[model samples]
Target: MDILQFEKQYLRLPSAIDEIHDELFDQKGIRVFVKRDDLIHPIISGNKWRKLREYIQIAQFNGYKHLISFGGAYSNHLYALAFAAKELGLASTGIIRGDELTSQSNLYLSQMESWGMNLKFISRTNYQKKLIPKEIDTTNSMIIAEGGYGKMAIKGVSYITKEINQGNFEHIICPIGTGTTYLGLCESTNNIEVHGILTLNNLKEIESNALEVGIPIQRIYDAYIFGKYAKQPEELVNFCQLFEQKHQIKIEPIYTGRMFYGLYDLIRKDKFKPESNILALHTGGLKS
Candidate 1:
């Protein structure tokens, strides 16, 4: 199948927006809505599909038959890429960190292998350097950065703004890992406050990335990164559970959970002006 056909058949573009209710928001005269990017697809859901679609188009356009990317054992990026490549009749390779790990090391890794992805595990040092293996062939392959971070991804993510009515929202917010989604929002939106909640202590890195791309960094919150990336503390876990119970929308501690937690804190603190319409992006880390 071709890339356009695959997108039309499998992907949900312009994902739905749902309004969330809370007494605090009411008290503050603020309206909260969530962009349900998680509903885009089951496996390749959220910003993953948004970030990968452009790369896939570029690959097919240039006659590339393979997609290669770097990630960890349980990387959602790799898992989604494997499934996307399989459905689109393309080859995929996942360059994983941690040399001790194998394809069978975890369910996600094994699943990637099952989807016909070539899993190459490398040492942490080499992974940091993003070294490609000597055995793997790079011809006709598109190398995607870890977490789908790149200018192309920023372009893909900017399409989210096209899906949204910019006039209706006063502020837009999303969780920042590599800052691709955040930067994309910053690039596309005018007269909207783009807020980023750092999932990890990478404020400096995100700022550097923004500056590199000529995006002015503003309203980035660093106080909400519970401890570090993927820490999953009890407070965050409980918050995710209650959030699920309250809204019936699933969220995990790694990304969406922290974002919502931080958003709620900001709301309570009156960080936003009264009567502000805020849109929070649910970037789907549930299966990652």
Candidate 2:
């Protein structure tokens, strides 16, 4: 389970931020840049890819035949985990949050099932009450906590800090789901303002958890949630379509699209100085 070897063999991804220049930022009257973690490995890419890499390594090292985790119906983490586990020759299971299975929403879940992932849908109350699935054989199996699984999940986020250090940027903005990526980015760097836009409402618990990990972060904006997790607004849908047309990049309404919308709003509101350098993290859940 040499992670280095795994990285070399399966984690070769492009940097999506390659050609961004001042001209792009000038349109918004602020100096803006992007960190393309989205281009990391196609399957095991983005924050989810980095966060799960070590967990997969540990599971394989421990000779686990199965990997179990949690997420919602359209969870990027679940999607990434299913694909990564299949790629690494391991069994995978997803404990989804809701019981209702809509035809439109079950496409990804069906795909995961096709990839040999066992899908279990639980009630929201039951899902929260049961953080770790009870049926799993913990003796030989590894259960990766959803949303980056604490400090160990920050390995991939450290790469963003390294990239920023190599460039000249004062502030970095990214969407906050479980706050794992935000924690990793903040802990791995200094002198840069880390702004997390909450993708869900009621993130006080996540904030406390991130602070406990000693990650300095500022919650500068929130995605308005639209009601709850995975819920989207017409504005967001329109923005997603417009963004893809302009940038030739597809963004899911769940995370990246919301963050981009927030960023644009912040710039429109004159939240940043025109001369300031800002870097927005494309945390890459676009494939949704």
Candidate 3:
């Protein structure tokens, strides 16, 4: 594979939006449509592609042959980056957050290794502050932040807002991990109310980061985190299963499920009156 092929997206662009016919939304006088970004690819789909697109191009343009990044044991960002690096024929190094995960075997970690990404395990303490060990030299690497949160990421994520806004939805709903997607939507849209269902509990930090980017959490739902990040309550799991059975669209408990759960909770509270058009951004990572 060459940089030219890497420059090509190699996946379907501008995914379709499916209108969900459910009484749960209809009775609330809200019309919900799901943006199927997951269909962009079987692996590198959704916001992952949006976040990485420019980074990949920049690395290739700058003559960088490697990509380095950070993530947790079950990070979809790492998963997508590993595969994207493989597809783009670029070398990658993944600095995982926990040192304990090095001894444990999991599909996510194994797949990253399979994609030829060198996996470096680090203690959570140093990982939080210093990140990777200094022995691993990344002189020619383009480093991507965890969950793809960076300035260049805003450029990629902004495309989602530009595309979704073309349909004229009153509200945009998405699951937030690093607030990069939410920030991009805020920077790109003019009239749409971007509502983020935060997957993590760091509201103060998220708001601070957004404010640093010139937009605060205008409308965010923090009640649906289910105690902490990546925790799947029994109720949320059941709701995800039932939602898949009803809508025939699979959603994992990590991101998309939490967004749907929060959306339903808001609807129950009469968040939206009748005749409100809502668009749910399905940011994918169904592998969980």
Candidate 4:
């Protein structure tokens, strides 16, 4: 089956909106809702699929046979790409950071290998430069950047704004990694506020991305990163567990947990106006 057919028959587009009620939101006279992009697919879910959709389409249409991308040992982007390439009848290569790692390093890498993705482990220094293997051929290949960060990714993520009923909400917020999703929302919206909660200390990078896209980097919050990316502090882990118990929805500390924590703190600090309706995106990296 083709990419369009696979998407139509399997992937969930325009993912559902779920209203989450809390006493804190009630006290603030605000309503909080979650854009359930996680429900898009069990594997290629959330912003992963959104960011990769256009890239896959372009590869298929332009007769590219191989899809190459960069990531770490447990990269959600690489996992999604491997599965997508397998399903779409294309080849894939994952240039993984950490020369010590291999297909046996973890279950994710093993799974990617099972999906026929040629995983090449590289040194940290070489990975920083995104150097591909000398033996690997680039002919008829589409190389996607780490975490799917690029103009095509921004274009893919921008569709979220169109999927959402923007008129119903005063603000839309997401976690910023490479800033693709945040920039896309900002580029696509005019009247509604686009807020970004930093999952890592990449504020300057995100600002540069926004500037490149000709969007204002006005509403990015930097106080919530909790030292660095993938830290998984005790408080954050606890919050994620409690949140799942309360809302019956799963969230991971790396991204969604940080975003939700920041959102709650912002509400407690009275950052938003009363009666405001805010939408938080669940960008789905819940592999565990």
Tell me the number of clashing residue pairs for each predicted model. 0, 0, 0, 0
Candidate 2 TM-score over all chains jointly = 0.87
lDDT by residue (tens digit), candidate 1, 160-210: 999999999999999999999999999989999999999999999998999
Error of 3 at 121 (Å): 0.3
Give per-residue CA lDDT, model 4, range 1-288, as digits (tens).
677799889988879999999999999999999999999999998899999989999998999999999999999999999999999999999999999998998999999999999999999999999989898889999999999999999999877888888889999989999999988888887688988999899888888877887867659999999999999999999999999999999999999999999999999999999999999999999874
Candidate 2 lDDT over residue span 44-116, tens digit each: 6678776886787777777888988888887889888999888778898888888775324668888889888
Which runs of model 1 end up more than 4 angstroms from their true locations?
none
Candidate 3 displacement at residue 101 in angstroms:
2.5
Q: Which lDDT values do the candidates have, in the order given?
A: 0.92, 0.75, 0.85, 0.92
User: Residue 18 of model 3: what lDDT?
Assistant: 91
Off by over 4 Å in 2: 19-24, 27-29, 99-105, 131-134
Model 1 quality (TM-score): 0.98
Candidate 4 local Cα displacement, residue 141, angstroms: 0.3
The list of candidate 3 runs beyond 4 A from truth reads 1-9, 165-167
What would you estimate as the lDDT of candidate 1?
A: 0.92
Two-way lDDT contest, 2 vs 3, winner = 3
| lDDT (Cα, tens digit) per residue for candidate 3, span 1-288 | 553464354776778889998887777878999999988888888899889988998998898989999988888888999999998889999899888886246888987898899999999998898466888888898988888898789888877876665556888899999988888887787778889998989778888888777764669889999999889889999999999999999999989999999998888899887888989999988764
